[model samples]
Target: MKATVYEGPRSVAVKEVPDARIERPTDVLVRITTTNICGSDLHMYEGRTDFEEGRIFGHENMGEVVAVGDGVDRVRVGDLVCLPFNISCGFCRNCEKGLTAFCLTTPDNPKMAGAAYGFADMGPYDGGQAELLRVPYGDHNCLVLPEEARERQSDYVMLSDIFPTGWHATQLACVQPGDTVVIYGAGPVGLMAALSATLKSASKIMVVDRHPDRLALAEEIGAIPIDDSKVSPVDQVNEQTDGLGADRGCECVGYQAHDPQGHEHPNLTLNNLVQSVKFTGTIGVVGVFIPQDPGSPDKLYKEGEIAFDYGLLWFKGQTIGNGQANIKAYNRQLCGLIQAGKAKPSWIVSHELPLDKAPEGYQHFDARDNGWTKVLMHPDGGSHN
Candidate 1:
């Protein structure tokens, strides 16, 4: 198989690698059609984490099942399926409770509780950024797509990560119809969070970001764009909500949060969320914050200890919910919305290249190039909408 191999900091290349094959009865072999380069992958791509070299680098994936293990009864060969970023055994206690992201059965380390393809410290499973992928717990992990999936791979593929993750943010923040919601960051996940808030009938949706391209995307979906580069984001949100703060807020920037000057502040977004939201409102965080950030200039961030505003939070009586999205818990319903022509996440996709061009895609995306919002790679030359 040819895969996008991570060589080092800000470096990747397409190289011939060992073929991925079914090694267990529950495994399924997929001929990957569409795979995505996610914002989370940048953590490894930028050398911010301890991601090993020579590993593949993709987690958002969808494809045609080429072969199914004998133990796989539901998913079959020739079925088009989208695999969630999380890999888990469905019979585990967490999975039984719909907390598949924290499943106790799939991590490489027994002390850990979750697993993801090609992610650092997640699992030993290879990612789907190649011509082929080996799916574990085939029947449990594969979300079989409808026949119409052949025409909408761009939208369906989002069910693997961002769309569900955005929806999960709203769920965590307790977004209700007629509620005023404010979102931090205007990246793909943040844009998806804006979209999710729109679908949930939020009365007012405000998206904060410095990028003109990303803020423009949020505006396209009817969200009020707050350009932090021009003014204070918290002030803008307060102005929009008549100084009451938003009813709900979401933090989507994670540990990489930075100012216009490009100085990284791991606690920037969380504290901003606290100040931007109402006194008794809820805050949902879906950003990627790891346990340790060795590359951080701040010593506390080096130890993964963010100086959060717990005193302000306690005084305001605000609530917070943070973690990885339980993708399996929402994929089915989100898929139905796509199938019914109610949602189209492909609107954010900015580039689609063949597998060999993955290196270019990563370079542009990691640099945060203008208009390079989301990039998708086609391994088998399939173009989905």
Candidate 2:
């Protein structure tokens, strides 16, 4: 099998690797059809994380189950399924409470509660960015897609990560119908958050980013685009909200956030959100923040720490919810919306290439190239116009 292997900083290669097969009684062998290169994947691609060489590099995946272990009863061969980024065992205490992202059973490190395929420090599971993927705890992890899944593979595939994650951001921010919401970052996740907020009937949605293409996507979906590169985002939000600030805010640009001049600031979005959201309003942060960044030039970020305006956060009495998204918590409902033609997250997809072209996709996306908002790879020679 050919898989995209991480070679080093800002590099990847498609090389022949040993076939991925069922390794346990609870495992399912999936013939991957569609997989995504995520923003979080860029963290590893840029060598910001401790992701080792020779590891596969995809987490958002969907495919047809080609084989299943005897223990897998619900999933069957030929069933189209989307695998959640989080690898969870259904019987864990956290799984019972719908906190599957923090499942206790998948990670080898007892101190780490969650596990993800092909992610650094997550677990030993390989990702689905190849012809085959070995899915652990098959029945629990595979999300069976509806019959029309093949026709909507691009949209359905998003249920694996960004769609649910964006919805999670809205959930964390406590976005209510008719509430005004402001989102920082117009990347895929930020655009999805705007879509989620729109579906939830938010009276006003504002998205901030420097990229004109990304901000245009947000505006396409009824969100007001704030070009932070041209104006202070906080001032724009305050101006739009009549100086009361937005009722809710979301931080989608994790630690890799930067100014228009390309200087990295791990705490930029957090501090900005604190000022943009009204007092007593809620904020949700779904951006990936690392525990350590040995490659960081900033001393505090080297220790995986950020210095944001916590004093003002406390004084404003604003509440914040932060963590990786519990994808399983919202995937089903989001999937339903897709099946019903109510939501089409595939609108954010900018490129679809064959598996061999993954390295190019990674290069363009890592550079944040114009028109490269999202990239989906098809291992079986699939293509979308």
Name the top lDDT candidate: 1
Mind giving the per-residue lDDT tens digits that candidate 2 earns over 27-136? 99999999999999999999999899999989999999999998999999999999999999989999999999999999999999999999999998898889999999
Model 2 lDDT-worst window of ten: 376-385
Q: Compute the lDDT for candidate 1.
A: 0.94
lDDT (C-alpha, whole model) for all candidates: 0.94, 0.94
RMSD for each of the candidates: 0.7, 0.8
Give the C-alpha lDDT of model 2: 0.94
lDDT of 1 by residue, 332-351 (tens): 99999999989999999999
Instruction: Judge candidate 2 at residue 296 and give its lDDT.
Output: 80
The residue-level lDDT of candidate 1 at 114 comes to 95
